[model samples]
Target: MTNGPRVVLAPDKFKGSLSAPEVAAALAAGIRRADPTADVRCVPVADGGDGMVDAFVAAGWKRVEVAAPGPTGEPSTAVYAVHGATAVVELAAAVGVAKLPGGRLDPLGSNTYGLGVVVAHALDNGAEEIVLGLGGSASTDGGSGLLRALGLRLLDADDRELDGADSDVATLLGRVSSVDRAGLHPAIARTGFTLACDVDNPLLGPAGAVAVFAPQKGADPDQMTELEAALTNWAAVLGTGYAEIGGAGAAGGTGFGVLAVLGAQVRSGIEVLMELLEFPSLVADATLVVTGEGSLDHQSMRGKAPVGVAAVAKAAGVPVVAAVGRTLLSPGEIRAAGFVGCYALSDLEPDPALSIAHAAELLEQVGERIAARRW
Candidate 1:
């Protein structure tokens, strides 16, 4: 094996166990076990959902706390990071599904209003640009609630304000007064807005927002139908082209609402994350790159963090290895997804909960094994 002194350790959190920082620390520990003098740099990654603030903080962004609404219509506080004039808003921090109580899981009543509150906070804080992380949402309101919070009202046939869910959009049979856009932060008009999403579901169809994601949000068959109908009506009202917009189904049509109403652009969450971390530049001088996430499966091939990191490493001509919590893909699938090789923590720990509980130790051990390997 070549005695190269360069190595880059970039990994996402194991989820429910270690955070991105902890994962990097464990991986670094393992790499050092193999070569005491190796040059290693750890840049933890996130797909715009969980650990996003930490990722930005690790990259030296300033953190600010703001008040936003929770999924249950209660006031909650969220933190965002600011780098220069850009403010990073993570929807998960505002209205994540996990925040909803078990018995109160009502997709029909839930909304992205809390997310709007976060955006408003960011704008008020003097951000010139907004980078919205659209993951881990609990609403299927087609972003209507979010827009309303930002001053866009959804009026029904009698011009009364509509309630939650995209299905409510169908009740509007005519034109309504334009929302007062003047109150919006001046920076919003001049500044760019980017949405970070991993899913590719369009706004409304078989593979679109309602059909694909509503069930996960606790929608029943009837509610899903209502939601789809509302989205269709809402699309007609806005006249925004939802036809080819991929990922419109993400975050219960939050993607759709943001694009149509707010004029936001969508990008791969992982791609955005990698660029934010400046991963390519970091891995360029490294002889090897290691990345991993909670699960390695077919979905990982579809723009998840680890695969995104691997793509960057591959472009730099650095071999990438993964130490995953579990292996859900076949051997062929893993190689095809741009990983040099993969190791499962489950293989070492056996029990799922135990594997997560000791994820750091397991990752460190796997990292040691990789460092010892003569490749």
Candidate 2:
């Protein structure tokens, strides 16, 4: 009745393919294959972003679906999760880049208004505490649109009422001069918000969201400049210097806006997620911990889910290993990341397409090898 070594399988999604649970299952299956009696525990994780809901759901949070606006003033829906008084909202589900119309990615036109809609619904459903996952956001409209969704009265320089919901980032924030909080959401006033952000970029500057993330979201140079100026104006109009603070640039300025208007506190997505998943308790007696993402790169060290998982494992004195689909970091970097070793799918397949196409089988193989490693 004695099982093999106790190994914890915790990994993020492979992106464009396997999900965190799927990846964890594949890894677990491999561990089982290597040692048929091995005790495997799967606790998939995410740093906010797309896989946030999956993590929460796996942790037993109840998911609720709601109709909401998209980033670009279109019909869209967002999924909200509840576990007692705590509710989770994912920006990606509301207005993520994937939600954009076919072949249409408009960085300047999108906003976080959809996120506000989800928040409002959560408040209405008796959530006293809210967690907003600020990943996969498709808007750079500052928090103007989000605040608007929460009932803030946006006005132009002429003191006329302006619609932040249907307005573009530049057009709306460009015309705004002042704000009226008299009509702000009552629930927003009573609720406390915790922001789940993966990045530490500020609201404005070279490393800021606009400068670094805009391009990834499909904004050209001219559009970036224009959006930045509008964000600058939006920040000034709101009068919160938190724009320059770290994490302000997350989700296209949703972080900055939420922090400023809602008085929300920002924390690393993995940090928050660990507490939610009770990671330390689960890993306390484990012989080893396994984690990974789609690609292990230089960015992984900065607070990605795997790094966060390793931090927890290191604290518990458990050795950490990673099984990634691909890796762009060197051996030195990998060792520096606190991984005793890494198993990359590409190393086995040597073909990117084959690795992705056969990720499950490859991941299973990596898992078996990790279990087989004596150390």
Candidate 3:
């Protein structure tokens, strides 16, 4: 083994192109090609959304596959990572956009019941501390589905039980005459929960979940209105205090359900994952740190993985650079985000389609450039 310059490759997934592991592998290959003697370490990171479990697994955590329902109540096998009593459950794994059946969107019909099932399973299996990463959700049920799964019963005025899935949010919550919590999982009281969220939108109003994110989930104007109204009623039932919490609107108000009912603490997804992965120590001995995501733009500077990683690297006095699939930020803007330099796959492949299709190849080239220029 040669005592060469140590290069740490830590990056999030290049969405729709490559997973974080693949990106790190391609970059590592390019770095090795540039200088075979260079010491390279691959540490894939995520912002507590997609690829979260993979990040934990990469760090020697155990992957536990549990059967949960998809957004539309379809059977799905989702995965969570467990290391000792600490478990990490990603909401996207159970009912994310990709998990929708046949690429069909059911904005009002979908719910987070599947995610609740996964969390319940984790707690039942002796998980003491569970980290719930919230994002990429497919529904706007305000997390009623999850709460129901955890043994909360929604009883209608007629004393009929309400189903969390396949029901419109407005109709669902509007019909709820009372909430029953006597059957809640016993382990819930004993477990500690941390919610990994990025956005700070409250659970209602213009800046809230339905108004800002329902459209992307295939909700039309009328559906949005209905969802908003439903969530309003949900807030009333769950107590208006939870509705106004920061990040309470995340994952279609799933954050509210967890925070209000389960009493979970909220935190930045990237920051939480960085702590779990021991990121500071990972870059402590590194000469150059590489970090990025699929895009480096206005959002990237605001609590994204690359920015989060850059902050850590900068704190350790290690120069940080980015290797993204594409970048919308100017060089000055990139530097302002705490990165010393930035590289993009789009730099080599101008076409968006070509860039995504060959992101690994382009990332390798970017990797080579990083080694030649920075290493």
Candidate 4:
């Protein structure tokens, strides 16, 4: 029953380990153990990727469970969050590469049709604002599958429907003649669709999705070349320059194709999630803010959740400390990003795998150490 500095805890998920809420709760517990008098506020955040549904659910949104399409063209039941007129959906949930059998990676065969199914569900259920998190996708298609799902006709030169499920990438993209919008869902035109994009890569060029990200998805040089050429053609037929738009390469070109269809707006995923949670108002009077993620690196500054939290706390004149599983950036780099301090768990444990295996214990220690620092 004591009052100390008000601390806000906002962290992204620890990649393959803890969820954002779990990380926040563990840190908060450690902080409380170190100083029972410390006031702590726990708010989870994401960079418009995984953990989005959980974050919104923690923020009081209803978790709506339904079956959407997986990357392999099969029905994969995934969950999306809905509250009032706003609906939150993650492309990964519906069409993540993890959905492939035996973790089979298929860039050409994968599609976004299941994602479109979920979007239609949200619209039919009265959602006006659709927030689409674009990350962890396994496909490299130019969102042609999603268009097909929404009743758009993807045709070849012979007026035959292009089969996203059965056809390979070469056949699908190489044969695409035109897109028919006559069957597009009516709600698609009226609803405000926003893409939660973390990366800034456009749809084409060296930094495009194919060149930069396709390798990780099991694409060889030949596959990448073909996919790139196919994506270029798909964009040409779609009749929009979404290919050059920043963030257009996200989620296998879901950003480009979806944005082209509705003229959607792109925003930083972390900022969108924070604003959705009203995080600034929650931390306005806090003495300090604590945030972190799995890794602190040069990329973290480029729109990751921790950096986003640091921006808000710094604006409110609150000091920020981050506790991370590991760090690839120098202390100066983090300091320049407005983080006053960071605790690295990788240093605490010598074994890399053991560190992630025991991340919870190490993170709690970090929280205690951060709290015990004499202020």
Best by lDDT: 3
lDDT, candidate 2, equals 0.87
- lDDT against the true structure, per candidate, is 0.78, 0.87, 0.89, 0.86
Best-matching candidate per TM-score = 3
Order the numbered candidates by TM-score, best leading.
Answer: 3, 4, 2, 1
Candidate 3: segments with Cα more than 4 A from true spot: none
Q: Which digits, one per residue and each the tens of the lDDT, describe model 1 over residues 1-375?
A: 445567777778787888888988998898798878777778888887777777787777898888777876877787888998888888887888866766367776677888888888777777777888888788777777678777776655565665444343323312332334554445567767888888888888899877887788878898788777877766666654863498777887888878876778889988987887677888887888888898888888888889999999889988889889998998888888788889899999999989988888998899888888754
* Residues forming the 10-long window of minimal summed lDDT in candidate 2: 164-173
In model 1, where do residues sit more than 4 Å from their true spots? 1-4, 102-104, 160-185
How does each model score on TM-score?
A: 0.90, 0.96, 0.97, 0.96
lDDT of 3 by residue, 1-375 (tens): 677779998899999989999999999999999988799999999987889988889888999999999998899989999999999999999999999999899997788999989989998899999999998999888788888889998988777889744456668877787788899999999999999977888999999998899999999998888888878888887789989999899999999988889999999999999998888999998999999999899987778889999999999999999998788998889888898888888779889999999988998888889889745
Instruction: List model 2 lDDT by residue over 1-375, tens digit each.
Output: 545788888899999879999999999888888888778888889998898888888778898999998878789787977899999888998889888888488887788788888888999899988988888877788877888888888788788989854656877887888889998888877889998888988998898888989988889998899888888888898755889878889988988888888988999999988997789999999999999999999988889999999989999999999899888999999988889888999999988888889999999888878878875
Residue 192, model 2: lDDT of 90
